[model samples]
Target: MSTTALSSSSTGSTGQPPPRRKAPRRPKPAPGTQRISPLRVIGLTVVWLFTAFNLLVLYWLIMAAFKTPLEIFREPLSLPATLFERGTPFRNFVYAWESAEFGTAFLNTVILVAVCSVVIVLVSAPAAYALSRLGVRGSGPMTAFIAIGMGVPFQTVIIPLFIAMSEIDLNNNLFGLALIYVALSLPFTVFLLTGFFRSLPDELEEAASIDGASATRTFWSIMLPLARGGLITALILNAIGLWNETLLAIVFLQENANFTLARALFTFYNAASYQSEYGGLLAGVAIIVLPMLVMYILLARRIITGLTLGAGK
Candidate 1:
Protein backbone atom coordinates (compact mmCIF):
# COMPACT_ATOMS: atom_id res chain seq x y z
CA MET A 1 0.00 0.00 0.00
CA SER A 2 1.11 3.56 -0.77
CA THR A 3 2.14 5.57 2.32
CA THR A 4 0.04 8.57 1.03
CA ALA A 5 -3.05 6.33 0.76
CA LEU A 6 -2.44 4.95 4.22
CA SER A 7 -2.02 8.49 5.63
CA SER A 8 -5.25 9.71 3.93
CA SER A 9 -7.21 6.67 5.24
CA SER A 10 -5.84 7.26 8.77
CA THR A 11 -6.81 10.98 8.58
CA GLY A 12 -10.35 10.04 7.31
CA SER A 13 -10.75 7.58 10.17
CA THR A 14 -9.75 10.26 12.73
CA GLY A 15 -12.13 12.98 11.53
CA GLN A 16 -15.78 13.21 10.29
CA PRO A 17 -16.36 13.23 6.54
CA PRO A 18 -17.36 16.54 4.89
CA PRO A 19 -21.05 17.49 5.10
CA ARG A 20 -23.01 16.34 2.04
CA ARG A 21 -24.88 18.89 -0.12
CA LYS A 22 -28.62 18.37 -0.52
CA ALA A 23 -29.84 17.41 -4.01
CA PRO A 24 -32.02 20.01 -5.77
CA ARG A 25 -35.71 19.36 -5.21
CA ARG A 26 -37.74 18.17 -8.18
CA PRO A 27 -40.48 20.63 -9.19
CA LYS A 28 -43.94 19.30 -8.51
CA PRO A 29 -45.68 17.94 -11.60
CA ALA A 30 -48.21 20.44 -12.90
CA PRO A 31 -51.71 19.42 -11.89
CA GLY A 32 -53.14 17.13 -14.56
CA THR A 33 -55.26 19.10 -17.03
CA GLN A 34 -58.90 18.08 -16.93
CA ARG A 35 -61.89 19.48 -18.76
CA ILE A 36 -64.66 20.77 -16.48
CA SER A 37 -68.06 19.37 -17.34
CA PRO A 38 -70.70 22.04 -17.99
CA LEU A 39 -73.41 19.79 -16.59
CA ARG A 40 -71.50 19.29 -13.35
CA VAL A 41 -70.96 23.05 -13.03
CA ILE A 42 -74.64 23.74 -13.60
CA GLY A 43 -75.65 21.07 -11.04
CA LEU A 44 -73.32 22.53 -8.39
CA THR A 45 -74.62 26.04 -9.08
CA VAL A 46 -78.23 24.96 -8.65
CA VAL A 47 -77.45 23.06 -5.45
CA TRP A 48 -75.62 26.04 -3.95
CA LEU A 49 -78.49 28.36 -4.86
CA PHE A 50 -81.03 26.03 -3.29
CA THR A 51 -78.93 25.78 -0.12
CA ALA A 52 -78.63 29.58 0.05
CA PHE A 53 -82.37 29.96 -0.38
CA ASN A 54 -83.08 27.50 2.44
CA LEU A 55 -80.60 29.34 4.71
CA LEU A 56 -82.30 32.65 3.91
CA VAL A 57 -85.70 31.24 4.75
CA LEU A 58 -84.37 29.87 8.06
CA TYR A 59 -82.87 33.26 8.89
CA TRP A 60 -86.17 34.99 8.17
CA LEU A 61 -88.06 32.51 10.30
CA ILE A 62 -85.69 33.00 13.24
CA MET A 63 -85.77 36.79 12.87
CA ALA A 64 -89.54 36.79 12.66
CA ALA A 65 -89.72 34.79 15.86
CA PHE A 66 -88.25 37.75 17.79
CA LYS A 67 -90.32 40.38 16.00
CA THR A 68 -93.82 41.64 16.68
CA PRO A 69 -96.49 41.00 14.02
CA LEU A 70 -96.31 44.56 12.63
CA GLU A 71 -92.49 44.61 12.42
CA ILE A 72 -92.45 41.16 10.82
CA PHE A 73 -94.72 42.40 8.03
CA ARG A 74 -93.34 45.94 7.74
CA GLU A 75 -89.62 45.12 7.84
CA PRO A 76 -89.31 41.42 7.13
CA LEU A 77 -85.80 41.78 5.79
CA SER A 78 -84.57 43.87 8.76
CA LEU A 79 -83.57 42.96 12.30
CA PRO A 80 -86.28 42.28 14.91
CA ALA A 81 -87.47 45.59 16.42
CA THR A 82 -88.23 43.77 19.69
CA LEU A 83 -84.56 42.74 19.93
CA PHE A 84 -83.70 46.39 20.65
CA GLU A 85 -86.24 46.68 23.43
CA ARG A 86 -85.56 45.17 26.84
CA GLY A 87 -88.00 42.52 28.07
CA THR A 88 -89.76 42.17 24.70
CA PRO A 89 -87.43 39.97 22.69
CA PHE A 90 -88.62 36.78 24.36
CA ARG A 91 -92.29 37.77 24.57
CA ASN A 92 -93.17 35.62 21.58
CA PHE A 93 -91.38 32.63 23.11
CA VAL A 94 -93.22 33.17 26.40
CA TYR A 95 -96.57 33.54 24.65
CA ALA A 96 -96.03 30.38 22.57
CA TRP A 97 -94.96 28.43 25.62
CA GLU A 98 -97.82 29.58 27.86
CA SER A 99 -100.80 29.93 25.51
CA ALA A 100 -100.21 26.68 23.60
CA GLU A 101 -99.02 24.70 26.64
CA PHE A 102 -95.73 24.10 24.79
CA GLY A 103 -93.94 23.62 28.11
CA THR A 104 -95.91 20.45 28.78
CA ALA A 105 -95.44 19.31 25.21
CA PHE A 106 -91.69 19.92 25.45
CA LEU A 107 -91.42 17.80 28.57
CA ASN A 108 -93.56 15.05 27.06
CA THR A 109 -91.51 15.05 23.86
CA VAL A 110 -88.25 14.93 25.82
CA ILE A 111 -89.41 11.96 27.89
CA LEU A 112 -90.81 10.08 24.90
CA VAL A 113 -87.73 10.71 22.76
CA ALA A 114 -85.36 9.75 25.56
CA VAL A 115 -87.17 6.53 26.38
CA CYS A 116 -87.61 5.49 22.76
CA SER A 117 -84.02 6.34 21.81
CA VAL A 118 -82.60 4.36 24.73
CA VAL A 119 -84.83 1.38 24.08
CA ILE A 120 -84.04 1.45 20.38
CA VAL A 121 -80.29 1.47 20.97
CA LEU A 122 -80.44 -1.18 23.67
CA VAL A 123 -82.42 -3.53 21.44
CA SER A 124 -80.49 -2.68 18.29
CA ALA A 125 -76.85 -2.92 19.50
CA PRO A 126 -77.10 -6.55 20.57
CA ALA A 127 -79.09 -7.59 17.53
CA ALA A 128 -76.68 -5.75 15.24
CA TYR A 129 -73.65 -7.40 16.86
CA ALA A 130 -75.27 -10.82 16.56
CA LEU A 131 -76.24 -10.30 12.97
CA SER A 132 -72.99 -8.70 11.83
CA ARG A 133 -70.36 -10.54 13.87
CA LEU A 134 -71.89 -13.74 15.26
CA GLY A 135 -72.52 -15.33 11.84
CA VAL A 136 -76.14 -16.14 12.59
CA ARG A 137 -78.17 -18.27 10.19
CA GLY A 138 -79.97 -16.21 7.51
CA SER A 139 -78.46 -13.00 8.87
CA GLY A 140 -78.05 -11.58 5.40
CA PRO A 141 -81.67 -12.10 4.39
CA MET A 142 -82.90 -10.94 7.79
CA THR A 143 -80.77 -7.78 7.60
CA ALA A 144 -82.06 -7.08 4.11
CA PHE A 145 -85.63 -7.58 5.27
CA ILE A 146 -85.09 -5.19 8.16
CA ALA A 147 -83.54 -2.58 5.88
CA ILE A 148 -86.55 -2.91 3.58
CA GLY A 149 -88.79 -2.04 6.50
CA MET A 150 -87.25 1.45 6.46
CA GLY A 151 -88.93 2.01 3.10
CA VAL A 152 -92.31 1.03 4.49
CA PRO A 153 -94.38 4.19 4.54
CA PHE A 154 -95.48 5.37 7.98
CA GLN A 155 -98.90 6.17 6.49
CA THR A 156 -99.44 2.53 5.55
CA VAL A 157 -98.89 1.32 9.12
CA ILE A 158 -100.91 4.11 10.79
CA ILE A 159 -104.22 2.32 10.86
CA PRO A 160 -102.79 -1.03 11.95
CA LEU A 161 -100.70 0.53 14.74
CA PHE A 162 -103.63 2.66 15.91
CA ILE A 163 -105.88 -0.43 16.01
CA ALA A 164 -103.25 -2.42 17.88
CA MET A 165 -102.83 0.32 20.48
CA SER A 166 -106.57 0.66 20.76
CA GLU A 167 -107.08 -3.09 21.23
CA ILE A 168 -104.49 -3.06 24.00
CA ASP A 169 -106.21 -0.05 25.65
CA LEU A 170 -103.00 1.95 25.24
CA ASN A 171 -104.45 4.68 23.07
CA ASN A 172 -103.33 8.21 24.07
CA ASN A 173 -100.60 6.61 26.15
CA LEU A 174 -97.00 7.92 25.94
CA PHE A 175 -95.70 4.44 26.75
CA GLY A 176 -97.54 3.00 23.80
CA LEU A 177 -96.33 5.79 21.56
CA ALA A 178 -92.72 5.06 22.65
CA LEU A 179 -93.21 1.35 21.96
CA ILE A 180 -94.41 2.15 18.46
CA TYR A 181 -91.51 4.53 17.89
CA VAL A 182 -89.08 1.86 19.02
CA ALA A 183 -90.63 -0.68 16.68
CA LEU A 184 -90.53 1.65 13.70
CA SER A 185 -86.98 2.83 14.50
CA LEU A 186 -85.44 -0.63 15.04
CA PRO A 187 -85.00 -1.46 11.37
CA PHE A 188 -82.92 1.62 10.63
CA THR A 189 -81.00 1.42 13.88
CA VAL A 190 -80.12 -2.22 13.39
CA PHE A 191 -79.16 -1.63 9.80
CA LEU A 192 -76.84 1.26 10.68
CA LEU A 193 -75.26 -0.53 13.66
CA THR A 194 -74.74 -3.73 11.70
CA GLY A 195 -72.50 -1.90 9.28
CA PHE A 196 -70.58 -0.33 12.17
CA PHE A 197 -70.17 -3.69 13.93
CA ARG A 198 -69.01 -5.37 10.76
CA SER A 199 -66.36 -2.68 10.40
CA LEU A 200 -64.95 -3.42 13.90
CA PRO A 201 -61.84 -5.63 14.12
CA ASP A 202 -62.62 -9.28 14.77
CA GLU A 203 -59.34 -9.76 16.63
CA LEU A 204 -60.72 -7.99 19.71
CA GLU A 205 -63.55 -10.48 19.94
CA GLU A 206 -61.14 -13.36 19.40
CA ALA A 207 -58.86 -12.10 22.15
CA ALA A 208 -61.81 -11.66 24.50
CA SER A 209 -63.00 -15.19 23.72
CA ILE A 210 -59.54 -16.62 24.40
CA ASP A 211 -59.68 -14.98 27.82
CA GLY A 212 -62.88 -16.91 28.63
CA ALA A 213 -65.23 -14.09 27.69
CA SER A 214 -68.59 -15.43 26.63
CA ALA A 215 -70.48 -13.86 23.73
CA THR A 216 -72.57 -11.71 26.06
CA ARG A 217 -69.60 -10.63 28.13
CA THR A 218 -67.46 -9.99 25.06
CA PHE A 219 -70.15 -7.75 23.53
CA TRP A 220 -70.72 -5.61 26.59
CA SER A 221 -67.14 -5.37 27.85
CA ILE A 222 -65.21 -5.38 24.59
CA MET A 223 -67.19 -4.43 21.52
CA LEU A 224 -69.72 -2.01 22.98
CA PRO A 225 -67.15 0.58 24.07
CA LEU A 226 -65.42 0.60 20.69
CA ALA A 227 -68.69 1.08 18.83
CA ARG A 228 -69.89 3.97 21.01
CA GLY A 229 -69.71 6.43 18.13
CA GLY A 230 -72.11 4.41 16.05
CA LEU A 231 -74.36 3.92 19.05
CA ILE A 232 -74.44 7.67 19.69
CA THR A 233 -75.21 8.30 16.01
CA ALA A 234 -78.06 5.83 16.19
CA LEU A 235 -79.41 7.45 19.35
CA ILE A 236 -79.32 10.94 17.85
CA LEU A 237 -80.96 9.84 14.60
CA ASN A 238 -83.77 8.05 16.41
CA ALA A 239 -84.26 11.00 18.75
CA ILE A 240 -84.52 13.43 15.85
CA GLY A 241 -86.95 11.18 13.97
CA LEU A 242 -89.15 10.64 17.02
CA TRP A 243 -88.97 14.34 17.87
CA ASN A 244 -90.29 15.31 14.43
CA GLU A 245 -92.87 12.54 14.23
CA THR A 246 -96.34 14.08 14.21
CA LEU A 247 -98.27 11.53 12.16
CA LEU A 248 -98.10 8.79 14.78
CA ALA A 249 -98.89 11.25 17.55
CA ILE A 250 -101.88 12.53 15.61
CA VAL A 251 -103.12 9.01 15.02
CA PHE A 252 -102.74 7.77 18.61
CA LEU A 253 -103.05 10.84 20.84
CA GLN A 254 -106.41 12.67 20.88
CA GLU A 255 -106.21 14.62 24.13
CA ASN A 256 -104.08 17.78 24.44
CA ALA A 257 -102.31 16.49 27.55
CA ASN A 258 -100.55 13.72 25.58
CA PHE A 259 -99.37 15.97 22.76
CA THR A 260 -95.74 15.76 21.59
CA LEU A 261 -93.93 18.90 20.41
CA ALA A 262 -94.71 18.22 16.78
CA ARG A 263 -98.36 17.45 17.53
CA ALA A 264 -98.61 20.55 19.75
CA LEU A 265 -96.98 22.63 17.02
CA PHE A 266 -99.65 21.55 14.56
CA THR A 267 -102.40 22.47 17.01
CA PHE A 268 -100.70 25.78 17.83
CA TYR A 269 -100.37 26.71 14.17
CA ASN A 270 -104.13 26.61 13.65
CA ALA A 271 -104.84 28.56 16.82
CA ALA A 272 -102.04 31.08 16.27
CA SER A 273 -103.10 31.66 12.67
CA TYR A 274 -106.65 32.36 13.82
CA GLN A 275 -105.39 34.70 16.53
CA SER A 276 -102.94 36.39 14.10
CA GLU A 277 -100.06 35.68 16.44
CA TYR A 278 -97.40 35.66 13.71
CA GLY A 279 -94.53 36.25 16.10
CA GLY A 280 -95.74 33.49 18.39
CA LEU A 281 -96.33 31.26 15.37
CA LEU A 282 -92.76 31.66 14.23
CA ALA A 283 -91.53 31.21 17.79
CA GLY A 284 -93.28 27.86 17.93
CA VAL A 285 -91.64 26.90 14.64
CA ALA A 286 -88.28 28.04 15.99
CA ILE A 287 -88.76 26.01 19.15
CA ILE A 288 -89.30 22.86 17.14
CA VAL A 289 -86.50 23.50 14.62
CA LEU A 290 -83.70 25.15 16.64
CA PRO A 291 -82.88 22.28 19.00
CA MET A 292 -82.17 19.98 16.06
CA LEU A 293 -80.21 22.68 14.25
CA VAL A 294 -78.00 23.39 17.25
CA MET A 295 -77.53 19.67 17.93
CA TYR A 296 -76.41 19.04 14.38
CA ILE A 297 -74.05 22.00 14.40
CA LEU A 298 -72.36 20.97 17.63
CA LEU A 299 -72.17 17.29 16.67
CA ALA A 300 -71.69 17.49 12.93
CA ARG A 301 -68.01 16.53 13.04
CA ARG A 302 -68.57 13.63 15.39
CA ILE A 303 -71.47 12.39 13.32
CA ILE A 304 -69.47 12.44 10.10
CA THR A 305 -66.46 10.77 11.72
CA GLY A 306 -68.64 8.15 13.39
CA LEU A 307 -70.43 7.43 10.13
CA THR A 308 -67.23 7.04 8.16
CA LEU A 309 -65.05 5.47 10.88
CA GLY A 310 -64.95 1.96 9.43
CA ALA A 311 -65.90 2.68 5.86
CA GLY A 312 -62.41 2.15 4.50
CA LYS A 313 -61.88 -0.97 6.56
Candidate 2:
Protein backbone atom coordinates (compact mmCIF):
# COMPACT_ATOMS: atom_id res chain seq x y z
CA MET A 1 0.00 0.00 0.00
CA SER A 2 1.08 3.65 -0.41
CA THR A 3 2.39 5.34 2.75
CA THR A 4 -0.46 7.96 2.75
CA ALA A 5 -3.11 5.22 2.31
CA LEU A 6 -1.51 3.10 5.12
CA SER A 7 -1.52 6.18 7.42
CA SER A 8 -5.21 6.88 6.61
CA SER A 9 -6.21 3.26 7.36
CA SER A 10 -4.25 3.31 10.67
CA THR A 11 -5.97 6.62 11.69
CA GLY A 12 -9.43 5.16 10.92
CA SER A 13 -8.66 2.10 13.08
CA THR A 14 -7.36 4.06 16.16
CA GLY A 15 -8.88 7.59 16.02
CA GLN A 16 -10.61 8.91 19.22
CA PRO A 17 -14.42 9.37 18.90
CA PRO A 18 -16.78 11.77 20.75
CA PRO A 19 -18.66 10.27 23.72
CA ARG A 20 -22.32 9.23 23.14
CA ARG A 21 -24.69 11.63 24.91
CA LYS A 22 -28.44 11.59 25.75
CA ALA A 23 -30.77 14.32 24.56
CA PRO A 24 -31.45 16.86 27.31
CA ARG A 25 -34.84 16.36 28.94
CA ARG A 26 -36.96 19.42 29.67
CA PRO A 27 -36.94 20.33 33.43
CA LYS A 28 -40.21 19.34 35.11
CA PRO A 29 -42.23 22.20 36.54
CA ALA A 30 -42.16 22.12 40.36
CA PRO A 31 -45.14 20.40 42.02
CA GLY A 32 -46.80 23.66 43.09
CA THR A 33 -46.53 25.24 39.65
CA GLN A 34 -49.80 23.61 38.44
CA ARG A 35 -52.59 26.12 39.03
CA ILE A 36 -55.15 25.09 41.64
CA SER A 37 -58.76 25.00 40.38
CA PRO A 38 -60.97 27.80 41.66
CA LEU A 39 -63.59 25.30 42.88
CA ARG A 40 -61.02 23.37 44.95
CA VAL A 41 -59.70 26.62 46.47
CA ILE A 42 -63.23 27.63 47.40
CA GLY A 43 -63.94 24.19 48.88
CA LEU A 44 -60.77 24.27 50.97
CA THR A 45 -61.52 27.82 52.17
CA VAL A 46 -65.04 26.78 53.20
CA VAL A 47 -63.73 23.72 55.07
CA TRP A 48 -61.17 25.85 56.92
CA LEU A 49 -63.81 28.44 57.83
CA PHE A 50 -66.16 25.74 59.12
CA THR A 51 -63.37 24.16 61.20
CA ALA A 52 -62.41 27.60 62.59
CA PHE A 53 -66.02 28.33 63.54
CA ASN A 54 -66.38 25.04 65.45
CA LEU A 55 -63.02 25.57 67.20
CA LEU A 56 -64.10 29.10 68.17
CA VAL A 57 -67.32 27.76 69.68
CA LEU A 58 -65.40 25.17 71.69
CA TYR A 59 -62.96 27.88 72.84
CA TRP A 60 -65.85 30.11 73.87
CA LEU A 61 -67.41 27.30 75.91
CA ILE A 62 -64.12 26.54 77.69
CA MET A 63 -63.44 30.22 78.48
CA ALA A 64 -67.03 30.76 79.57
CA ALA A 65 -66.68 27.82 81.96
CA PHE A 66 -64.36 29.94 84.11
CA LYS A 67 -66.16 33.26 83.80
CA THR A 68 -68.52 34.89 86.28
CA PRO A 69 -72.13 35.39 85.10
CA LEU A 70 -71.55 39.17 85.00
CA GLU A 71 -68.37 38.71 82.91
CA ILE A 72 -70.10 36.26 80.56
CA PHE A 73 -73.07 38.63 79.92
CA ARG A 74 -70.83 41.74 79.63
CA GLU A 75 -68.44 40.24 77.05
CA PRO A 76 -69.83 37.09 75.57
CA LEU A 77 -66.97 36.78 73.03
CA SER A 78 -64.07 38.01 75.20
CA LEU A 79 -61.83 36.10 77.62
CA PRO A 80 -62.78 36.11 81.30
CA ALA A 81 -61.93 39.41 82.99
CA THR A 82 -60.44 37.51 85.93
CA LEU A 83 -60.60 33.72 85.61
CA PHE A 84 -58.89 33.39 88.97
CA GLU A 85 -61.36 35.76 90.67
CA ARG A 86 -62.15 34.35 94.13
CA GLY A 87 -65.68 32.98 94.82
CA THR A 88 -67.29 33.65 91.41
CA PRO A 89 -65.95 30.82 89.21
CA PHE A 90 -65.53 28.40 92.14
CA ARG A 91 -68.92 29.23 93.65
CA ASN A 92 -70.68 28.85 90.30
CA PHE A 93 -69.26 25.37 89.76
CA VAL A 94 -70.14 24.38 93.33
CA TYR A 95 -73.67 25.75 93.03
CA ALA A 96 -74.18 24.07 89.63
CA TRP A 97 -72.82 20.78 91.00
CA GLU A 98 -75.17 20.82 93.97
CA SER A 99 -78.25 22.11 92.13
CA ALA A 100 -77.96 19.60 89.28
CA GLU A 101 -77.12 16.62 91.51
CA PHE A 102 -74.02 16.19 89.32
CA GLY A 103 -72.56 13.48 91.59
CA THR A 104 -75.45 11.10 90.87
CA ALA A 105 -75.58 12.15 87.19
CA PHE A 106 -71.85 11.52 86.77
CA LEU A 107 -72.09 8.06 88.27
CA ASN A 108 -75.14 7.24 86.16
CA THR A 109 -73.44 8.40 82.95
CA VAL A 110 -70.30 6.37 83.67
CA ILE A 111 -72.29 3.20 84.34
CA LEU A 112 -74.54 3.74 81.33
CA VAL A 113 -71.63 4.31 78.93
CA ALA A 114 -69.64 1.34 80.24
CA VAL A 115 -72.51 -1.17 80.25
CA CYS A 116 -73.77 -0.09 76.83
CA SER A 117 -70.31 -0.32 75.27
CA VAL A 118 -69.82 -3.86 76.59
CA VAL A 119 -73.25 -4.98 75.39
CA ILE A 120 -72.69 -3.46 71.92
CA VAL A 121 -69.31 -5.14 71.52
CA LEU A 122 -70.67 -8.48 72.65
CA VAL A 123 -73.75 -8.49 70.41
CA SER A 124 -72.23 -6.83 67.33
CA ALA A 125 -69.00 -8.89 67.26
CA PRO A 126 -70.84 -12.20 66.98
CA ALA A 127 -73.39 -10.82 64.50
CA ALA A 128 -70.57 -9.43 62.36
CA TYR A 129 -68.64 -12.70 62.56
CA ALA A 130 -71.65 -14.72 61.43
CA LEU A 131 -72.41 -12.30 58.61
CA SER A 132 -68.79 -12.20 57.46
CA ARG A 133 -67.65 -15.83 57.85
CA LEU A 134 -70.60 -18.14 58.22
CA GLY A 135 -72.49 -19.29 55.11
CA VAL A 136 -75.79 -18.59 56.79
CA ARG A 137 -78.87 -18.19 54.58
CA GLY A 138 -80.06 -14.60 54.01
CA SER A 139 -76.82 -13.15 55.42
CA GLY A 140 -76.70 -10.53 52.67
CA PRO A 141 -80.29 -9.42 53.24
CA MET A 142 -79.79 -9.43 57.00
CA THR A 143 -76.69 -7.27 56.69
CA ALA A 144 -78.50 -4.85 54.39
CA PHE A 145 -81.49 -4.71 56.74
CA ILE A 146 -79.28 -3.93 59.73
CA ALA A 147 -77.44 -1.19 57.79
CA ILE A 148 -80.78 0.35 56.79
CA GLY A 149 -81.31 1.14 60.47
CA MET A 150 -78.62 3.82 60.13
CA GLY A 151 -80.76 5.73 57.57
CA VAL A 152 -83.84 5.77 59.82
CA PRO A 153 -83.99 8.84 62.05
CA PHE A 154 -84.20 8.17 65.81
CA GLN A 155 -87.11 10.61 66.09
CA THR A 156 -89.37 8.17 64.26
CA VAL A 157 -88.85 5.46 66.90
CA ILE A 158 -88.44 7.52 70.11
CA ILE A 159 -92.11 7.47 71.06
CA PRO A 160 -92.43 3.76 70.35
CA LEU A 161 -89.25 3.00 72.31
CA PHE A 162 -90.50 5.08 75.23
CA ILE A 163 -93.80 3.18 75.31
CA ALA A 164 -92.01 -0.17 75.12
CA MET A 165 -89.60 0.81 77.92
CA SER A 166 -92.51 1.93 80.09
CA GLU A 167 -94.35 -1.35 79.43
CA ILE A 168 -91.27 -3.20 80.73
CA ASP A 169 -90.99 -0.80 83.71
CA LEU A 170 -87.45 0.16 82.57
CA ASN A 171 -88.02 3.89 82.17
CA ASN A 172 -86.08 6.28 84.46
CA ASN A 173 -83.50 3.57 85.07
CA LEU A 174 -79.77 3.42 84.17
CA PHE A 175 -80.16 -0.12 82.79
CA GLY A 176 -82.95 1.13 80.53
CA LEU A 177 -80.66 3.86 79.16
CA ALA A 178 -77.89 1.29 78.65
CA LEU A 179 -80.25 -1.00 76.75
CA ILE A 180 -81.38 1.83 74.48
CA TYR A 181 -77.79 2.91 73.84
CA VAL A 182 -76.81 -0.62 72.81
CA ALA A 183 -79.69 -0.83 70.35
CA LEU A 184 -78.97 2.61 68.89
CA SER A 185 -75.23 1.86 68.46
CA LEU A 186 -75.58 -1.69 67.11
CA PRO A 187 -76.20 -0.89 63.42
CA PHE A 188 -72.99 1.08 62.87
CA THR A 189 -70.93 -1.17 65.14
CA VAL A 190 -72.04 -4.30 63.29
CA PHE A 191 -71.42 -2.66 59.93
CA LEU A 192 -67.84 -1.65 60.78
CA LEU A 193 -67.06 -5.00 62.41
CA THR A 194 -68.46 -6.97 59.47
CA GLY A 195 -66.13 -5.08 57.16
CA PHE A 196 -63.24 -5.69 59.53
CA PHE A 197 -63.95 -9.40 59.82
CA ARG A 198 -64.34 -9.79 56.05
CA SER A 199 -60.94 -8.12 55.56
CA LEU A 200 -59.26 -10.82 57.73
CA PRO A 201 -57.65 -13.64 55.73
CA ASP A 202 -59.39 -17.05 56.00
CA GLU A 203 -56.12 -18.98 56.10
CA LEU A 204 -55.95 -18.73 59.91
CA GLU A 205 -59.43 -20.24 60.29
CA GLU A 206 -58.62 -22.97 57.78
CA ALA A 207 -55.40 -23.83 59.60
CA ALA A 208 -57.23 -24.06 62.92
CA SER A 209 -59.81 -26.36 61.33
CA ILE A 210 -57.09 -28.57 59.96
CA ASP A 211 -55.75 -28.90 63.49
CA GLY A 212 -59.21 -30.25 64.58
CA ALA A 213 -60.42 -27.02 66.20
CA SER A 214 -64.16 -26.36 66.45
CA ALA A 215 -65.64 -23.29 64.69
CA THR A 216 -66.31 -21.56 68.00
CA ARG A 217 -62.74 -22.27 69.15
CA THR A 218 -61.31 -20.98 65.89
CA PHE A 219 -63.35 -17.77 66.22
CA TRP A 220 -62.74 -17.15 69.92
CA SER A 221 -59.04 -18.15 69.91
CA ILE A 222 -57.66 -17.15 66.52
CA MET A 223 -60.08 -14.70 64.90
CA LEU A 224 -60.95 -12.52 67.87
CA PRO A 225 -57.29 -11.94 68.81
CA LEU A 226 -56.47 -10.95 65.22
CA ALA A 227 -59.38 -8.47 65.24
CA ARG A 228 -58.25 -6.59 68.40
CA GLY A 229 -57.84 -3.32 66.53
CA GLY A 230 -61.37 -3.47 65.16
CA LEU A 231 -62.79 -4.37 68.58
CA ILE A 232 -60.96 -1.42 70.18
CA THR A 233 -62.34 0.91 67.55
CA ALA A 234 -65.89 -0.37 68.13
CA LEU A 235 -65.53 0.06 71.89
CA ILE A 236 -64.21 3.62 71.55
CA LEU A 237 -66.93 4.69 69.13
CA ASN A 238 -69.73 3.12 71.21
CA ALA A 239 -68.32 4.60 74.41
CA ILE A 240 -68.33 8.09 72.91
CA GLY A 241 -71.78 7.68 71.40
CA LEU A 242 -73.32 6.36 74.61
CA TRP A 243 -71.54 8.99 76.69
CA ASN A 244 -72.92 11.91 74.70
CA GLU A 245 -76.42 10.55 74.12
CA THR A 246 -79.04 13.00 75.45
CA LEU A 247 -82.42 12.80 73.74
CA LEU A 248 -83.24 9.17 74.55
CA ALA A 249 -81.83 9.63 78.03
CA ILE A 250 -83.99 12.69 78.64
CA VAL A 251 -87.14 10.98 77.37
CA PHE A 252 -86.71 7.67 79.21
CA LEU A 253 -85.30 9.24 82.37
CA GLN A 254 -88.14 11.62 83.29
CA GLU A 255 -87.52 12.01 87.03
CA ASN A 256 -85.17 14.72 88.31
CA ALA A 257 -83.41 12.11 90.44
CA ASN A 258 -82.72 9.97 87.33
CA PHE A 259 -81.27 12.84 85.27
CA THR A 260 -77.98 12.47 83.34
CA LEU A 261 -75.36 15.21 82.92
CA ALA A 262 -76.97 16.03 79.58
CA ARG A 263 -80.45 16.34 81.13
CA ALA A 264 -79.08 18.28 84.10
CA LEU A 265 -77.72 21.00 81.79
CA PHE A 266 -81.27 21.82 80.68
CA THR A 267 -82.34 22.48 84.27
CA PHE A 268 -80.37 25.75 84.10
CA TYR A 269 -83.05 27.08 81.74
CA ASN A 270 -86.28 27.63 83.66
CA ALA A 271 -88.79 29.64 81.59
CA ALA A 272 -91.16 29.70 84.60
CA SER A 273 -88.58 31.56 86.72
CA TYR A 274 -86.69 32.99 83.69
CA GLN A 275 -83.50 31.87 85.48
CA SER A 276 -81.02 30.83 82.78
CA GLU A 277 -77.60 30.56 84.39
CA TYR A 278 -75.43 30.91 81.24
CA GLY A 279 -72.07 30.69 83.06
CA GLY A 280 -73.04 27.51 84.92
CA LEU A 281 -74.61 26.08 81.77
CA LEU A 282 -71.41 26.71 79.81
CA ALA A 283 -69.37 25.19 82.66
CA GLY A 284 -71.60 22.09 82.65
CA VAL A 285 -71.14 21.73 78.89
CA ALA A 286 -67.36 21.97 79.28
CA ILE A 287 -67.46 19.28 81.98
CA ILE A 288 -69.58 17.00 79.78
CA VAL A 289 -67.20 17.42 76.80
CA LEU A 290 -63.99 16.91 78.81
CA PRO A 291 -64.35 13.13 79.09
CA MET A 292 -64.81 12.75 75.33
CA LEU A 293 -61.68 14.82 74.66
CA VAL A 294 -59.63 12.78 77.13
CA MET A 295 -60.93 9.51 75.63
CA TYR A 296 -60.00 10.55 72.06
CA ILE A 297 -56.51 11.60 73.15
CA LEU A 298 -56.00 8.28 74.92
CA LEU A 299 -57.37 5.97 72.20
CA ALA A 300 -56.39 8.01 69.11
CA ARG A 301 -53.63 5.55 68.15
CA ARG A 302 -55.89 2.49 68.28
CA ILE A 303 -58.63 4.33 66.36
CA ILE A 304 -56.16 5.34 63.64
CA THR A 305 -54.78 1.80 63.43
CA GLY A 306 -58.21 0.19 63.16
CA LEU A 307 -59.52 2.68 60.58
CA THR A 308 -56.36 2.36 58.44
CA LEU A 309 -56.33 -1.44 58.70
CA GLY A 310 -59.98 -1.72 57.62
CA ALA A 311 -59.52 0.85 54.82
CA GLY A 312 -56.35 -0.71 53.37
CA LYS A 313 -58.08 -4.00 52.63
Best by TM-score: 1
Clash count, one per candidate: 0, 0
Model 2, span 59-163: residue lDDT tens: 888888788777877887897767575645465577667777788888878877887898899899989999989878999999999999999999899999989
Q: Write model 1 residue lDDT over 1-313, tens digit each, in one string.
A: 9998877776686665656799999886544423566666777899999999999999999999999889999999799866558667898998999888998899999999998899999999999999999999999999999999999997998888888889999999998988889988999899999989998898999999899999999999989999999999888888888888888898888788999989898888898999999999999989999998899889888888877874545
Q: Name the top lDDT candidate.
A: 1
Q: lDDT of all predictions, in order shown?
A: 0.89, 0.82
Root-mean-square deviation of candidate 1:
6.9
Assess every candidate by TM-score.
0.85, 0.84
Give the distance in Å from residue 236's predicted Cα in candidate 1 to where it truly belongs: 1.2
Q: Give the Å shift of residue 234 in candidate 1.
A: 0.7
